[model samples]
Target chain A: MSLYYVQKFIYNINRDTKLQTGFAANADMILANYDLTDEEACALREADIGLLYVMGVNGQLLMHYAAYRGLAWDDYIQAMKDGLAKYGEVRAGSYVTIDGGAGGAV
Target chain B: MSLVFAGLCSHAPGITARAERAPAELREPFFANFNIMRQQLEAAKPDALIVIAAEHFANFFMDNMPAYAMGAAPYYEGPIEDPDWLKIKRRKIPGNANLSFRLIKTIMQDIDLAYSEEWKCDHGIMVPLHFLTPNYDIDIIPVNINCQTAPFTPLKRAWAFGKALRKACDFVDERIAIVATGGISHWPATPNSGKINEAWDRDFLDKFARNDKTALLAYNDEAVYADAGQGGAEIRTFIALAGAVEGRKINIAFYAPIPIYAVGCTIAMVDLDES
Candidate 1:
């Protein structure tokens, strides 16, 4: 799963503006350093919030990453919804889409 | 001097970021209560404020997470999330290294912990500070209970940490104030954001208000995850608040489900006895 490294990359990039600058320019270069599986690498490279979420990225890290990527709050929620529909469910980690996010969310 | 004030409040970033999105009826009243806590906190004239928060990877991360941590620094900076996104401007927050060191030394006597010279206050600390210490006049001492990572702090240990904190506050010369911030039940930052479990929240908060240590510590993580969602695990911060004021009843200033804010919004304070 390499979820730890995925979260670590997000954690580091979230705080380190210099790393973020590099990431903005060449995601492949940044993605290559982390030991991510092919799926993890693809999701991150595409800035695919939903897939990363489906891969079990903690929303704490994922939300910030989504914001850093210029996705607004509403967009961030929508991406996760799209992700739940596309990928089916959260694969790992603490976050999950309850009832396919069809209920309870305001 | 011992503790001059003690309180608990919510720290959802949305409280500031999405201020206009939530219904004014719920958001305004919740804010008024927070302002009430602030007025009361200022009246205590505390020398420093110790914030016990469940920081979301703002400072410590899973790479090497500590069960508990305290900040010992002359000054700290934060709202590590982009100022624009969080809607809380980034700034250098004041802190007291000397007071923090003294408190940490005593707290460590009872509980092992990591102390950091540098800390980035995420929504966890900044959101509370935004309401309670809007002026940033009081020196801050940030304390963190790891609520995000797994193998979380045991309920009993969290209570013990609170007891140790109370003892340390008593031992210090300054008129200290402690506030633990976290939600009782809700899913934050997920697809199911804005989901509110009012029944679960009231049941938990009731145990908290009474300082029912037995009932409070009885919560199992597995069950908490099932009923309260992963974010429910943040109860450790609230449980610690309960322990800090053990045997005393807390006056809840406010509690309601603000779905758009994404948690059972809460504000409360312990009525400390000063002789």
Candidate 2:
């Protein structure tokens, strides 16, 4: 919906060891609880940061998700930039890219 | 009244590990300012450091969020996970339990904040300590301001918190350095997160350098969030520090808009004369 499920999924997994262990064991099942779109679920399953960015996950949550995936900080940042290039526009959120540039819709 | 030294530092992970990713052009100014701050710290020779920084849900979470708290543990074992990708090494930081306990008692006289006898130091506290106090020899009093969690401490309240914190520091009999970490306009993780609000950053830095606490404290909550982003709310940490050192001259040693960490790396200080 509003990247809420995706954000929640990441937030929970980052904090809860049981959830992280479960997610590592069966990500799809662990992710099934959150009200996520197929695309959001797929992105989480694949650790697709670009798609997650397009889905409007807040950067704070996304940063940890990137770390959870073991993506280096620079690579995590690059994935977001690449998301803008691949996805055409930030679909929705507090920071939708305007004019395909760095400025966003606060 | 022995506040021998005080300064503001950026806890951006990049500031600590710039060599790994930041280009020479970007890294140059960042380190130059750090060197300046380091020299100042060396000159101050403070026996203890009171670091005011934000918690990234590292220790506290939604269910048990305290607006403000002090880590009273004898040693801050550092972060469980290094979000900086091992750019900075983890070290057990020495905690000043004696001074921390005294501040707890003294500051309570003015405001009812919280404290913890057990909590580890996250990057918000460690990053500055890593950069400014590499040896980890000085006794640290880590004061955590919940800048990340919502229903945050208000700007005015942060100022008042600083005022009371100053009183607490005065109660303790030791040369102490106060440090505030974070801010100047950049978000993390979002697509446009790395973009710098240079105008906002410069203006805020200028006001801080001029010791214009009135202008700083006057900023509405919405304006700050809109301009600095949520994490930038950590500016409250600086405001509280400002409360302690108001009316004194300030030196803005360095500032760099680092896209790698999505933060403007700023370092500033108010040199106090104990004479």
Give per-residue CA lDDT, model 2, range B1-275, as digits (tens).
57888899888655554454666787787777777787788788887888888866556755577888888888886653444563666567888787788888988887787988877665677778877888888888888887775677888889889888888887778887899887768665565656778889999888878878788888876787777765567888888888888777678887777776568778888868722
Per-residue error (Å), model 1, residue B138: 1.6
How many residue pairs clash (N, CA or C atoms closer than 3 angstroms) in each of the candidate models, in the order given?
0, 2
Off by over 4 Å in 2: A1-58, A81-106, B17-20, B83-86
Q: Model 1 clash pairs?
A: none
**In terms of lDDT, which candidate is strongest?**
1
Q: Residues B1-275, candidate 1, lDDT per residue (tens digit)?
A: 89899999999888998888888888889999998999999999999999999998989887789999999999999887888998988888999999999998999999997999999898989999999988888999999999998999899999999999999999989999999999877777787888878899999988888889999989999999888887899999988888888888988889998877888899999988722
Worst 10 residues of 2 chain B by lDDT: B79-88
Best candidate, TM-score-wise?
1
